[model samples]
Target: MQDIAREAGVSSKTVSRVSNGSDSVRPATRDMVLAVMDRLGYRPNFAARALKRGRFKAIGVAMFDIVATGNLLTLEGITKAASDLDYAVTITMMGKGQQRSLAAVVERMKNLPVDGVIVILEQMLPDVGTFVPPAGMEVLLVTSAQSTTMSTIDEDQYGCSTMVTNYFLDRGHRTVHFVSGPEESLDSHFREQGWIDALARRGVVAPPVIRGDWSADSGFNAGLELAHVKDCTAIYAANDNEAYGVMQGLAAAGKRVPDDVSVIGVDDVLRNLIPRLTLTSVKMNFGAVGRRAFRMVARAIEDPQRSRPTRELIPGVLVERSSVRDLTR
Candidate 1:
């Protein structure tokens, strides 16, 4: 510190402020100190800092799977939020069951230098009761499931599902068929329940749901089955990938979208990749959920006394496109 301070023509205190990213230091002085440090190959001792302050200025994020689109987007949001708050993030991917247990993962995160941890819930973490955090470890769960023990931030899956189902119903479709995601997913369950509730409200008998693995291939397979059902006019896919597959299957079966089988999906991801399809989907702000989850973790870390377990739900909006056809018109 003294060498860098002398080299930059600044006091040791000024060097300390610059190293800590204090805004009180003038921009030019900060830059000069940074340049001197770079020239000297100086790196801040995070371990010592953590030991002194009882914080690492870092957070750990654990996910059961990283391949899902929703998880990917949520992670993006988390990193952005963490960066904005000047905190570092360490990510850990837990492999499939028995391969890596939640207990083991939590232990690993506890060993990390992070002050708080955020766990992105998946099939593995279905029962929060089974998992417990280390002492004084602040934890947040990003999931649709309700949890009384941990803070949670999730997208309004049920409400969005109802909106899409009602969207098809209002278009004069007798009933909307559903292509659900994997059975184990809480998100899929919520969406499926919403579809059922929507149908029940209109006194319409809900059709059998076609199950998918949250994949375009699964959707295509479900779509092929729907093609065989003559009365299948409107379809609500759990996600965009499934909807895309359904479109393919319908096309292969000589079914025209909107004109023959109207389709809607959740998670507006398909529009960005398949612009020509013009898919009408429920737009979920997974990014916002991620950001909020990070903020909650930060609060828990910074002010543990005031931080309480809270559940926050992010709403979804229906993005209209050319996929649904109005029969009443």
Candidate 2:
């Protein structure tokens, strides 16, 4: 630090600030200090720093799968947020056998060099019990896993589904059919509950749900079946992949979108595809969920004794496009 400070002609405090990623130093000063450090091959010893501060300045992210688009976006948000705070991130995937218990699964992350952990639920069993992290370890849950007693930061699955259903109903569609994610998924559970609740609010009977595995193929299969239902004029799929598949199936069955039937879905992640169809979908902010989850976990790390919120729901919005028809007009 002294050598770099002298080389950069800045006080040791200025060098320290730049090295610690503090923004208080001017850009020019920070740059000069960084250049000096690079020339001197001076890399801060993270191990020593962690020992001195009693914190790793790193976080662990545990997930079932990151291949899914929403999960992938959430991870990106978390990593970016961690970077901004000058913290490092370590990631691990939960094993299927570990699904027996949330705490057991989380215990796997204890060996990781992170100050805290963020468990991202994907296929968390509905019956999985409460998660109690190892003593002195802070943890947060992200996404849908209603079974756990752990604090969670979830995307508004119920609200998104309810909003989409109500949009169809308000547009004069008497009732709406739903294509739901797999039953084991908490996201699917909340979304299905919302769809039914929304219909009941309007005194309309909620139709039987068509279950899908969060895949376009399952959605395509559901679409084929829905084609024959006489009153199934509006459909809300659980996700964009399934929604796109549903549209294709509807097309195959000679059911023109927004004409013979209209369809809307969640996770506008794929709204760009099927350019002609242009799905009117709800936009899920998984990235925001990730950012917020990271921030929440960081706070826990900062003050382990502070109170933590039980849950936080990040709401999404509707992006109207061509797929849904305004029947009232």
Most accurate candidate by lDDT: 1
Listed in order, each prediction's TM-score against the native is: 0.92, 0.87
* Model 1 C-alpha lDDT per residue in residues 256-298, reported as the tens digit of each score: 9979999998999876576476788889998998899999999
lDDT scores for all predictions? 0.87, 0.84
Clashes of 1: 0
lDDT against true structure, model 1: 0.87
Can you list the residue pairs that collide in candidate 1?
Answer: none
The TM-score, computed over Cα atoms with residue i paired to residue i, of candidate 2 is 0.87
In model 2, which residue pairs have backbone atoms overlapping below 3 Å?
Answer: none
Q: How far is candidate 1 from the true structure (C-alpha RMSD, Å)?
A: 2.0
Best by TM-score: 1
lDDT of 2 at 280: 87
